[model samples]
Target: MEGFEIRLTSSKKGKGLFATKKYDQGDVILEEDPLVSCQFAWNAAYRYLACDYCMRQMHYPPETTSIMLLVRILAYIQQSSDPSAAIAKVKQFCHRTENEDAELVHKLLGEQFTHQMNTLREMTSHVVSGDEVQEFLTPEGFCTLMALVGTNGQGIGTSPLAMWVNSVLEITMSDDERQQLDLFIDKLYQYVEEESGSFLNTEGSGLFQLQSSCNHSCAPNAESTFPYGNHRVQLKALKPIMPGEEICISYLDECTLQRSRHSRQKELAQNYLFVCWCERCSSQASEPDCTSEEEMSDEDIDADD
Candidate 1:
């Protein structure tokens, strides 16, 4: 994290990140690790091979991601010895949506998610046995975790070449044992060849504390990326930003930029529970019929994917 500060100000957005000083275009503004990183338990059916820490794709072993995520969560619970603290941290994220049906929508989603968590707990019970994890297995705790992840999670991708190299080095043996390992090596190479081309296929989601506070902007001055190819994300200035500017990142895709103001607002309201009042949205309101090509940019959109 660099050149930014968090403050509770009188701004309509409430708490947000502001520039500490002027930053040039392309300057890295902030870098941070997630408060919690987990595999998309809902997407286990998709069978993507993501990194356990960053949720980026891996090449060698596809089965490790989901199991590793469970292991990490279990380890956190064991080490902290207080599951309530973890739940409290997750509760800090915003889960309110401004949609007309927001309450009903949240209730339905929470119930479904709670059931899923319970099912996951049962499935992993054999491997993860302890009272610490059990404390967080209540219906209420599961719902809280789901709400936090739904509102704040960010998807990350990793490089396949790096994962492949790392996987190869993990297996080693003495000179005499090398002969015995030949068959295993040959099969491993075969698996690598079969899985080689789909390097970027792995994707996972996580929650970042500071990044989550940055509000939405259709024409944002800053953008976020996983520059180190892991869970650590970097927020970079898309253009020169002066001190006191509210750092914003888009919460919708390029396609949203192509839509009219009403349509954009509708999507944002439904998904993020807020109405967009950014510069572009304001301009569009004045020029209802104008389809400005400049409105669209490679802005990162945040939502449950």
Candidate 2:
């Protein structure tokens, strides 16, 4: 907040954070701990030594990773396209931004109907008292919470082993000492893998107040990192940025960024509901519109989140 201000974009794309001073590549523009954070059940494995990064990254595992839209989240329970009328049979719930009737979840979490039933029953059962009950606790509340986390929760990747390696490399040491240490590290990992067979630090996601203000761009000038290897995030400049420039981050991952204009546009629209107007997308205006080489899935979005 010191060197940046939240205000409306000149392009009228709603509010965004703009630089109050210049920033060089690799310079930290901002650092923030989450306003509120949560651990997913999968993150329970974080107690293990081999962090989540070491485990083969799962691509598009629908059961654990896909994000469902509020509208579609409701439809799974509503069992029909008329979500508003459908929810009236259960309880009053929040309306959708894109449209009340949209079935966007068909593309994201199409097979989560049973998951919703179980989650709603389990989640609502915990309401100990009416005084403590929040409005977001009905069948619709399940949809609201899923959509909220999907849209806003930022993923946290942490690794203690990586920290040890970085610290060892930072210290001055003889070449022979370095070789010995490298061998020791390799053997240590091998030993751990053999013993644990399967181990990982679960990646958790969180919501950050200030960091969330940074808008999306196909070519983001600044990016978020977790060099300290925890939930805390530091916004670092990817390229030099001058005063008055808007700091942005990509909502998609490295693989997704290389997608066609149409493919990129489709994901952004589905996730964020706005077509990206970044320079990279605009420059490729003439590219043929089609689906991506690999269908964009919740797994891809999860990687970025």
TM-score of each: 0.63, 0.66
**What does candidate 2's lDDT look like per residue over 1-305, in tens digits?**
46777777988466688899888999898898764443344434534332332222221111242232222233334454564554443332223543311234323344575475456446444532132233344555445445554555566556566667778888888999999999998898788678755434335555566787788899999998767776688989999988899999998877778877777887788776677889998898877675554555644765675
Q: Model 2: clashing residue pairs?
A: 46-201, 46-202, 51-201, 155-305
Expressed as tens digits, the lDDT of each residue in 118-181 for candidate 1 is 6765666666657767643455544444444445666554555555645654678686676656
Report lDDT per candidate: 0.63, 0.61
In candidate 2 the C-alpha lDDT for residue 299 amounts to 43
Say which candidate scores most in TM-score. Answer: 2
TM-score of structure candidate 1: 0.63
Which 10 consecutive positions of candidate 2 have the poorest summed lDDT? 54-63
- Candidate 2 to native Cα RMSD, angstroms: 9.4
Candidate 2 local accuracy as lDDT? 0.61
